[model samples]
Target: MRPQQGMIPWGPNTTAGGRAGTQGGEGAVELVMVNPTEQAAIPRGGNSLQSQPDGKGHFGGVHGGRFVAETLMPLILELEAAYAKAKADPAFQAELAYYLKDYVGRPSPLWFARRMTEKLGGAKIYLKREELNHTGSHKLNNVMGQILLARRMGRTRIVAETGAGQHGVATATVCALFGLKCVIYMGATDVERQKPNVFRMRLLGAEVVPVTSGAGTLKDAMNDAMRDWVANVADTYMLIGTVAGPHPYPAMVRDFQSVIGEETKAQMQAAEGRLPDVVVAAIGGGSNAMGIFYPFLDDSSVRLIGVEAAGHGLDSGKTAASIERGRPGVLHGNRTYLLQNADGQIEEAHSISAGLDYPGVGPEHSWLHDIGRAEYVGITDGEALEAFTFCTEMEGIIPALESAHAIAHTVKIAPTLPKDALIAVSLSGRGDKDIFTVAEHLGVTL
Candidate 1:
């Protein structure tokens, strides 16, 4: 692979391997028979009718209610109330916009990938350049909003879990911005693979705690963070990075992230004079996809496609293709689709992309998939790597491996469309952090 700025071939691998994919949510379609029939479980073009989650955190009879120990319930209740108030407060909204503009750099570009579009020979492709955001990637969008709420709740410390380290870095960035004590729990394996990000967090004055339990992956990191939150509920705010935790969290995070789609809608119409034919994003825990897909849900004409990580292949027993092959199960405090074995135990998820390596997806995503509001497909590691290379060479952009999954899928379908069609891919993050991973994948030492 060719080199780009901030990339050099002089050291051992310092970043996790390239991502397989990342993980997504719900609405207007319905909230009742999750999988009424076996045929409806995987619909063709989301054509099948189905039921889904209720307002009380139960999707299609799948409960997303809290299952935490009693000690944390009071704080959870308090958090729920605080969030409600904050959501309705004008002051909170104003502050959030101000930071998004002046600090996190809002209004990320929606650029037409002319070269890539021309190469594809059919659809006009747009890159929602979220990688250009201040802290790099869409993670900062949620981090800033959550930190603002944390400050409003009088919390003195911030705690979060991270997989590929982007969210951890973004959380650390906001904590430093707010002058709050920050503690980040990262899997020990992630810490090693993401050494640069670990140093970056420490450089920003956040403690990077290496979690050793389990496989020391993203799931294990989350477990450790939850334990920490319970131990210090009064003083610490558990800043969940994705839309998977519990009630209010999935909805809350989606609201904060909706900015991506909100911007995309206005920007696309302004640029193309019409809505795009399709909008696609990578899913790990489903934040970026939800952000981009939520605003377009009511627009029945616009297609929403979410790409998942098929680490090896769907039949390999090592992929993270939850919606495509997983069963409905509870994980990480929410009931959602998860990869599990016959014994009902959650299986380890594999993805070259650290961010997409989770056993389950957000509950709302489960609802969406069931109701046919959106469609999901899997992209393998090699395919994502190829897309990563193509984007850099063709569009002069190096995307995060997580984001590459979306691009990998986009390229496949875009070329088959008419020239009048438009396809937009959320360039979720920069790939500077994934150089080592790519090097490893290519049998090269950085």
Candidate 2:
């Protein structure tokens, strides 16, 4: 079923097609979706961006569609069809749920940040501990879901891209479990910097290819992965790492990761007896943030905040703060906010954290920002570094640097809120892979 803005879109219409609406049980099937209230308000030269696609598979309104070469377009279309069929099948959902519980460790805790809350002294903070997942990051949520769909499509191999190496490791881990041949394209720079994760992927029986063009980060790596998928279209499955890319991918990845928000909603009600006052996560290609933000879109009382990477500072001309600083543009096969210049050429993004160093974000986030359903902000490397230290020392949680960005923003806003106010942070990944970078930044040897 198309994930709409509701507590549970899995009612009567979830199968065969979602009801007109899942909750209200009215409307057409909108997979890359939005509630009626959600639509693109941002005008481009006087026209509004298409925010919601109907049954025709318009994807993410005007912001997302298949924007690839004709040869690759057919592959994307086939994947979309396969996914729709799989979602409608009871067996597919059953098996996916079973593996999520038995293998990838679902229902990640929404633990109250007792120490951090007391330390902040204002808002109560709860962490959706996605870091505790088997692969140590939220990336596996998407990888596993896509791989299952890939298998059903009769695809025999998997190809993916990674930046900080967390995704690469996660993809490789799952590939080995299913005995699928896996190839992960990573930036040459990332392969060198995130060595632990690189070694982990290699040990998991996946081939890692390093791309050297562009700034040697996620975007470059994605380009290479897309190329590989096109060249080997018949047998290869391109497992996109995040909620970016085109059409069904952003929608597909968001649905897979939505489990984070799904669990958080139940856990928050169970923990605090009500919904959180605010939900926060860092946005790179925006999957983690989307996972946590999607469920709460219709809750007017709850604030959804996305923190982007501000490499040095927003004004430093070296930031990955796309939603905050970018204008409308197309990149990586979908139209979305992008770091571009006067001539509309894509600019390289800079962030100390490899995972957050992308020039574009998931298209749904772009739509959300335009519609004012969510807020986007920027956190700098220095601030994120300090936040990383805070979580490590104060809470004994050495968060992934990308998660540190959200933590940094949390401390800034949480302390300013009322004492009873609540904030839920998606601690999206663990810090083991980031230890080397953190140590080097601190001028210390590990």
- Candidate 1 — what's its lDDT? 0.80
Say which candidate scores most in lDDT. 2
**Which sections of candidate 2 miss by over 4 Å?**
1-60
What is candidate 1's lDDT per residue for 131-245, written digit by digit as tens? 9998789999899889999999999999999999999999999988879999999999999999999999999999999999988999999999999998898799999999888
Candidate 1: residue 444 Cα off by (Å): 2.1
| TM-scores, all models, native as reference | 0.87, 0.89
> Against the correct fold, how does model 2 do in TM-score?
0.89
How far residue 149's Cα lies from its native spot in candidate 1, in Å, is 0.3
Model 2 lDDT tens row, 121-154: 9999999999999999999888888888988998
CA lDDT, candidate 2, residue 16: 29
Please report the candidate that would top TM-score against the real structure: 2
